[model samples]
Target: MKKINLIIATTLFSITFSIGAFAQTETKIGALIGYGTEIENIGIGANAEFPIMEKLTISPSFIYYLPKDESGIKINWFEVNANANYYFLDEENIDVYGIAGLNYSSIKVKYENSFGLGGDFSSSDGRIGLNLGAGANFNIGSSITPFAELKYVIIDGGQLVVAAGVKFNL
Candidate 1:
């Protein structure tokens, strides 16, 4: 948990400086924090975005789980994702977006019993998906805009995944 927090902090620091230096360009960069539900687990993820077009962007993200209980013991997982966002409504500084892309996930399961099965399991595969979400910019007095969004990732076998987050634009 300590290490995860440290990595997130470091990533945010780098993003801050990089955004400051790249503010003059059209490149949009920011950090995202949000929760997701997959396979009965709650996840927290962070994302970094880079624009490829006025209506398109690429975002790479990672997620982790706080220790959870199943019946009596504890378990956890880590996930990673990369996807593209297409702005369906691009106007002013706000954009309502839809996304379609692939994701790679690594899930780790731990058990109370030291002799339990599935030792340090990791699964990585291409998941094809889509997301429908909206984001609006907060027009404060600063160049860094505040935004909020909600999205759902539709997985195979009709499993529904949801995410919501607040972000600072740069």
Candidate 2:
């Protein structure tokens, strides 16, 4: 509970900071499909980009991994990330950026006996993590932009994540 609160507070602070620093700027919101190395599964999520400066942006995204079941055990996982992206190469067609961020990961597990013996159990855990990576955005002279990112989260066992999707500017 305390950890969750901390994550919320930190996210709010980053958003506030970005708005305070740049009140008038274009924002982008979009959906993405992601792959996580630790879970070896694909996830789908939403993301938003808030430009804080000409070459810097604050991005927040969430990813939920598809639940997997094996041998009567089920697992569910998700992550929330707030990252700062520094664009090294900003162009009309493509924008490349470096990433650094905070990550919060949670996973749950449930087990059930197939024989219907009434013996079942469940468990869950959450952890705070850090991320570092790089990504690029492609603009085709429209309101919609496609982007791809590869980031590694350093936390509880560590994981590599890759995402790609389109964002709409607004």
Quality of model 1 by C-alpha lDDT = 0.56
The global C-alpha lDDT for each of the candidates, from Candidate 1 onward, is 0.56, 0.89
Q: What is candidate 1's TM-score against the reference?
A: 0.61
Question: How would you encode candidate 1's per-residue C-alpha lDDT over 53-158 as one tens digit per residue?
Answer: 6777766566665657676455665555556777777566566666565544434454444567655433233344555454544445455655556556665542
Pick the TM-score winner: 2
For model 2, residues 60-84, the per-residue Cα lDDT tens digits are: 8889999999788899998989899
Q: Tell me the RMSD of model 1 versus the true structure.
A: 6.1
Off by over 4 Å in 2: 1-23, 116-118
Off by over 4 Å in 1: 1-24, 39-42, 114-141, 156-159
